[model samples]
Target: MSKMDIYRRSQFFISPPAILKVIEVLILVTAMILFLVDNKCSGDLAFVTIFVLPCVVVALATLISYISAVFVLVGRRNPLTTPTWVKGDVWFNIVSLVVMLVGSILTLTNEGCANNSLTVASIALGFISVILFAISGAVTYLVLVRHQQEVKEAQRAQLNTRRVTMSELA
Candidate 1:
C-alpha cells in the first residue's frame, strides 16, 4: 500500500474494519426488511418464504460479526480478539458472503417473486454486503500476513545484531 492509502486508512475515528462492521450490520438489517416485505407480497407465501431464509441467516451472522468487531475494538485486555478469532472472522465472512450472493441470485431469478422496487433494492443490498464481506476478509487476512512478515523481520534484525556483536568481540 502507498503512504496515502495507509494514511487515509488509519485516519478514521475507528479502524476501517470496525466501521465496516457497523455498516454491514445496517445493510443486513435493511436487506432483511426488504426481503421480508418482498416475500410477503409475492403471493404464494410458502414458496416465497424459502427465498427469505438466507437473509434471516445473514442478519444473524451480521449480529455475530458486530459482536466480534466490538471485541476487537475494545480497549486493551479484550480477550475476545486472538489470532484464532481473526481466522474465524475471515472464514465466517467468506461463507456468509457466498451465502448472501447465492440468495440474491435466487431471489432475482425466482419467478414467484415479483421484480418490484423492493426486491431490486434488496438484491442491491445483498451485493453491497458481498463486497463488504470480501473486503473485511481480505483486510483481516492481510493483517495476519503482515504480522508474520513483521515477525520475520524482527528475527532477522535480532540475528544481525548478534552477528555484529560477535564480530566486534572477535
Candidate 2:
C-alpha cells in the first residue's frame, strides 16, 4: 500500500473529532482576541445582540456536548463488548445537538447588555465550548478504529499459526 493507504488503515489515525477540536481551539482564540480588542464596541446594541450573543450561546452548547462525551467514555459501567468509545460518541453528538438547540433559543431572545466586555467574554467562551466538542468527537473515532485494528491483527495472526501447524502435520 502507498503511504496514504497505510495511514488510512491505521487504528490510531486522527479522526474527525480530533480535527474538530483543533478548529474549536482556533475559534476560541479568535473570540478571545475579538473580546480584548473591542471591549468598548458594544454601543451598537442591536448588532451585539444579533451577532455576538448567538456565537456565545453556540460556544457554550458545544462545550457542554464535549463534556457529556467525555463522561460517557470514562464511565466504567459497561462490559468490554459494549464499545464505550462509540457509546460516548453517540451521547456526545446527542448532547451537542441539544446544546445547539438551547443556544439557538437564547440567541433569538438575546437583548443587548450594557457591559461590552462581558458580552465579548461570553462570546469567547462559546468558541471554547465548540473546540471541546470537536475534540471529544475525534478521540471517540480514534479509539474505535484502534480497537477494530487490534482485533483484525489478532485474528490474522491466529489464522497464520493454524496454517503453519497444518502444514507441519502434513
Candidate 3:
C-alpha cells in the first residue's frame, strides 16, 4: 500500500470517534451551563429538578463517553488486538440511555417558569441534546462494527487463499 493509504488507515484508528466524543462533551457542557444560569436567575426548586438534574446526568454521560473513546483509541495502537472500540461503543450506548431517561424524567416534572415560553424553550433544547447524543452513539457503534467485520472477513479470505495455494503446490 502507498504511504497515503497507510496514513489514512491509521487516521481511521482514532480520529472519527474522538471527534464525535468531543462534540458530545461540548454539547453537554453547554447545556449544563445554560441550565445552571437559568436556575440561578430564578432560584426556583422546580428549575433544579427539571433543568439542573437532567443536565448533570447528561454531563456525566458525556464524560463517560469521552473516556471510553480514548481507551479504545489507545488500546488499538498497542499490542492487544482486543478491539477496544467495541467496549467504547457499548459505553456510548449506555450514556445515550441515561441521557434519554433523564430527559424523560425532566419532561414529566417540568413546571412553567415566570416566562412560560423561555421554560419551554430550555426544556426543548435539553430534549434535542438527548436525541443528538443517542443518534451519535448509534451511528458510531454501527460504523465501528461494520469496519471490524470487514477487516475480519478480509483477513479470513487472505488466509484461505494462502492455504489453498500451499496445498496445491504440495
Candidate 4:
C-alpha cells in the first residue's frame, strides 16, 4: 500500500465512533488504575474485582469487535465499516451504555468508593464514559440512517457512479 492508503486507513481512527471507542477504553483504564490504588490500600482487590472487572471485559470485547470488523471489512462496500463509510457501531455503544452504567452505579454506591479519593475519581470517569457511549450510539445511528437513505436514493437514480465504476475501489 502507498502512503495515501496508509493515511486513509489511519483516518478511520479519527471518526466519531472511533474517537469515542478510544475515550471509553481510556476511561476504563483509569478505572483500572483506581482499582490498583484500592488494591494497594486494602491489600485486596475486592471492590475492583466486583465492580470493575465486568466493565473491563465488556468494553475490551466491544473495542476488539469494532476494530476487527473494520479491519476485516474495510475494503468492501460493507455497511458496517467501509473505507469511506461506517455503520453498525451504534450497537456497541448502546450496549456499553447499559453495562457501564451498571458498573458505575455499583462503584458509586460502595462505601469504598466514597472513602477513597482515587475510587471517586475513577467512578466519575466511568460515568463520563457512559455519557460518551450514549453520544457515540446516537452519532453512529444517525450515520447509519443517512447511509441507508443514500443507498435507497442511489437505487432510484438511473446512473450510479459506484455501479458504473468497477475499479478496485477501496
> How badly does each model clash, as a count of residue pairs?
0, 5, 0, 0
Task: Give candidate 4 misplaced runs (Cα > 4 Å).
Answer: 1-11, 38-46, 78-88, 159-170
Report the error of model 1 at residue 118, Å. 1.4
| Per-prediction TM-score | 0.76, 0.47, 0.67, 0.71
- Residue 31 in model 1: lDDT: 80
Which should have the higher TM-score, number 2 or number 4? 4
Candidate 1 lDDT at 169 equals: 100
lDDT of 4 by residue, 81-146 (tens): 342334446666767788878877876777646677777777778788889888877876665566
In model 4, pairs of residues that clash are none
Report model 4's TM-score to 2 decimal places: 0.71
Judged by whole-model lDDT over C-alpha atoms, candidate 2 comes out at 0.51
Cα displacement (Å) at residue 55, model 4: 2.9
For all candidates in order, the CA lDDT equals 0.69, 0.51, 0.57, 0.66
Instruction: Give the per-residue lDDT of model 1 (tens digit) for 40-133.
Output: 4447665455446766787778678767655554633221224676688788889988988887777777765545788778778988999999
- State the number of backbone clashes in model 4: 0
lDDT (0-100) at residue 111 of candidate 2? 47
Q: Using TM-score as the measure, which candidate wins?
A: 1
- For every candidate, C-alpha RMSD to the true structure in Å: 4.1, 8.1, 4.5, 7.4
